[model samples]
Target: MDVLVLIGRILFAALFLASAAGHLTRTKMMAGYAASKGVPAAVPATIGSGLLILVGGLSILLGIWADLGALLLVVFLVPTAVLMHGFWKESDPQTRQLEMVQFQKDLALAGAALVLLALIAHAGTDLGLTITGPVFDIN
Candidate 1:
């Protein structure tokens, strides 16, 4: 169970980590995309979001302040989904469908992040450790 939880954390963090790397490496491209989506201060926002994602992903991955990390993810995902994936504003059916898919994906991730935050708060400890303390407690 501990191993599974650790694996889940790693898997959850991987998406944000990879995305942060992409945002940093492809800053110009990401900024251009953000600009097309009408994001104010697109370039700076891209860079800032990259940093936020990096910090959040690392915190979650390391199990250090996972609650804060989850909150960061919620902050990043909500605006991003609404701003970048505005399916309702799309006129083209294909584009609308694609944007809707992305929006749904973002919402799902946000939900997962919220769940993680709730779990961390409920457990009153870092999620890296077993909720019951010992990993293999049989009692």
Candidate 2:
């Protein structure tokens, strides 16, 4: 079971880790895309979002404050889905479909993040054989 949890954590954090790499590496390009999609303060937003996911990913991967990391992911996912992937605002059918998919994906990830948060809150993070035990003395 602990092994399963470790694997699941790695898999779940993979997407965010990859995304953070892209965000940090291609800041200007990503920021331009965000600006085109009408994001205010796109550059800083891109950097900040990258950092959020980075820290969030690291926190979860390291099993330190996984709850907080999950919350951070939720914060990033919800607004990003609403602000950047508002499919309803798209007119072109194909583009709308693409945006809708992205929107759905983001929401799905957010849902998963929320579930992780709930599970951690209820069960506590002291589950069996965690590679990295809970930190800061919180159970």
Candidate 3:
């Protein structure tokens, strides 16, 4: 069970880590997309979000401050979903459906992070690994 939990954390963290890398490495491309979605100061926002997810992913992957990591994920995920994946704004059915799926994905990820946040907050040292750390003993 513990190993499974670790694996889950690794998998979850991987998603953010990969995204962070993309956000950092492909700043211009990502920024252009973000600009298209109506995000102001898209370049900085892209970089900033990249940084946020990088740190958050590290925290989760390393089993340190997992609660904060989960919180950071929630912070990033929610607003991005609402602002960037605004399916309702799309005129074409296909585009709208795609955006809706993206929106739902973001929401689902956010919800999972929120659950981790709540669990970590209560579990403290115990959750330091999955919920917080079997590593640095930091939350």
Per-candidate Cα lDDT values, in order, are 0.84, 0.85, 0.85
Off by over 4 Å in 1: 126-139
* Segments in model 2 whose C-alpha atoms lie over 4 Å from true places: 129-139
Which digits, one per residue and each the tens of the lDDT, describe model 3 over residues 46-128? 99999999998888887777778888999999999999999999999999999999999999999998776676566666543
Clashes (N, CA, C under 3 Å) per candidate: 0, 0, 4
Model 3 segments more than 4 A misplaced:
128-139
Q: How accurate is candidate 2 locally (lDDT)?
A: 0.85
Per-residue alpha-carbon lDDT of model 1 for 28-111, expressed as tens digits? 999999999999999999999999999889877877777778789999999999999999999999999999999999999999
On the 0 to 100 scale, the lDDT of residue 135 in model 3 is 26
lDDT, residue 46, model 3: 99
Evaluate residue 49 in candidate 2 and report its C-alpha lDDT on the 0 to 100 scale: 98
- What is the TM-score of candidate 2? 0.91
RMSD value for candidate 1: 5.0
Candidate 2 lDDT over 22-121, as tens digits, reads 9999999999999999999999999999999998888878787777788899999999999999999999999999999999999999999887766665
